[model samples]
Target: MCGTCGCGEEGTVSIRKPGEDTGEHTHSHSHAHDHQGHAHEHSHQHKHAHSHAHEGHQQHHESSHGHEHGGNGHHHRHEREIQLEIDVMQKNNLLAERNRGYFEAKQILALNLVSSPGSGKTSLLEKTIKDFKSQKKIYIIEGDQQTMNDADRIEKAGAPVVQVNTGSGCHLDADMINKAVKILEVEDHSLLFIENVGNLVCPSLFNLGEQKRVVIVSTTEGEDKPIKYPNMFQSSDVCIINKTDLLPYLDFDLEKMKEYALRVNHQLEFIEISVKNGEGLNKWYAWLKNLSL
Candidate 1:
């Protein structure tokens, strides 16, 4: 009897010796035993042993395919990715070197002014231009995120000015200044002031071929500015504390601010000025005149 087909269920097969009785019970019992043996052999070969090996091999192949996709999938195209990431900063640095050489060739003293938005940098420049109009030929490169307002003010003060709108860049890089320099008539032995975009952080990292870096800090700003933004203070050659006339109206601690600044940069020169009142600008003019000599 076949195990899967259940052929013994229809009828019993009789098998007897020559003189023995042929019993249906004996025949049915023997057929059931043969069916059970067949089932065991079939299960061992196909369902239990073979299925487990096939499943394990399929899992191993899938794991190997996943690993290949995850590791070194871009090995053949790594060179193109590296070329795309070639340093943008290196190009800016080279332009800065060229601008420095150009400044040297023209014999012009350039100053890059850096500060926050309302540090009165433009007001200070206007006052400086007015004070030194007869002493020096002043030229300005105005950098801002938007309009030509600062450049207009400088021009009304009777100085040659060029405005650079950086669109959305946070700071003016050396390449921007190099292009702006060509627009302005920078005579030999003139004072070229580059009013950098009103940002304290990013502007300090860029050198715009300036002989001096001046940072403008106002009395309205807290006295702890020197310590909070130490990089700007440390990079500056001159620190101008603008709006000193407001000292009586505000609770500003001048001595502490100066102390912190000197601690950060021992060689930093400082000037106190109020462009509105025309006070303390003489000292600033004197410093610029000395630079030219």
Candidate 2:
């Protein structure tokens, strides 16, 4: 009796030698049926490699004879299998759908505000909330890895606010928005603004059930930002060139930035504003009204 098998000698274990054309061999076993008629199959023509087994004590081996035969043919097959199995960005898309449905149910016009830190997402929201407080019941969902500072500013503007701390997560997902919505007392005629964690990359991939996605690009960040971070601009329905008040001080090319943004996303509607001076905000508010309506 073989110590490894723990089975009788009648149970035969056969090992086959690697063929001349064989680069590598792999084995997979399934015990759905009895092993009495089990057989192994091999192919030399197939560049990719895979294995399937049915109820058998099968052993596979590799040989150096064909090791350099087009650089590990079996390894390439394994890689293809792995690539096929990957979801890529399925998780994020699914979560985005859930968030979208939730917002639809609530009848809340949610807006995702994305930008680099210090691009004045907070200040823009602050000014907007102050101006629109009398006419609209605005609610804010502030997302940050730490601190309640943004939410605090929104609160001072007299709008209902909820702060979501994502911990180490770089972006907000549907689950976060789902929970954040509960804390916000959004009425029938209400606007929900989600201040996405300041990031040009990660935030664009996430959808927080927002009616609109607005990307804030500051003049100080330069006109090349639209070209460099095309994904963010591409995803946004609106692009706000904030801090235009400093355009005189900085050598920012406004026309070139608009041209680049249009090249990337022809449908992008934009507003140039400075929250400090309250310039270009009325146009923004008007656009928001038309969208919400």
Candidate 3:
């Protein structure tokens, strides 16, 4: 399982290129059903550490105080797990720094856009690409658990794209981005948008070496989302309050949401936009354009 979220890792985080057949792809998990309000923990991502059979095996040892090392009891295992978690995160941070250096060298403006499911991230991306595709070289890395649907939409929007299906994993860590970047072969002086998996909680703990982390929150979601999921709001460099066209029909308080977000992140840049009607999108586009300069 992915050490980041404790979800089963049997799912494939495969990179799918446009025009390639997906018939050969097979996975053990699909759909976003894994993230059901569980507090995401350190995913001890070592290959041999955990297995599905471990569940059945663990049930057999109620006490679990094996005498393999002279009855060290559960305390030894707990300490070891904590150490391993630290080690894994250290390794991920190191790799993320490497990715940052690579992007700096290539002059690539990489933005990591994160949000909850159905936050209109893809819609915003489509509009962003359409707005600047002719003047800029844009590449996309789409992350999901099971399908290439988002990547297909992005490809139709006139940009080179790669989809990384994270199977059951709730979030995409830096190692995933490191591999995805190699597959994208992103050019110099271009923009790389990594549309991370639709998760608000687990994705916050891991940094994918992005130049900016843009978190999108729709008007349909509660204004208290910032307080409920403060980590993402605090970590994000920019927060886009999307779907402003629905604001008239919804009861969401725009100013209240901004207040909550600012409470968590005083310096978070905000851009309110509606991809449906082109309202406030110019500012969003300009924000992106200035980042490259």
lDDT of 2 by residue, 206-243 (tens): 67667789999999987988899999999999999999
- Every model's TM-score: 0.70, 0.70, 0.78
For model 1, the run of ten residues with the poorest summed lDDT: 73-82
Model 1: clashing residue pairs? none
Give the poorly placed runs of model 3, Cα more than 4 Å off. Answer: 1-4, 7-9, 22-88
Cα TM-score of candidate 3: 0.78
Per residue, candidate 3 scores C-alpha lDDT tens digits across 1-293 of 44434655555557777777762343433345456323123233322354432444444445545545433232222222333435546766888899999999999999999999999999988998999877679999898887778988999998888888877778877888888788789999999999999999988988889999999999999999999999999999999999999999999999999999999999998999999999999898788889989
- Model 2: colliding residue pairs: none
Question: How many steric clashes does model 3 contain?
Answer: 4
State the lDDT of candidate 1 residue by residue for 227-284, as single tens digits.
8999999999999999999999999999999999999999999999988897899899
Q: How many residue pairs in model 1 have overlapping backbones?
A: 0
Q: Model 3 misses residue 270 by how many Å?
A: 0.7
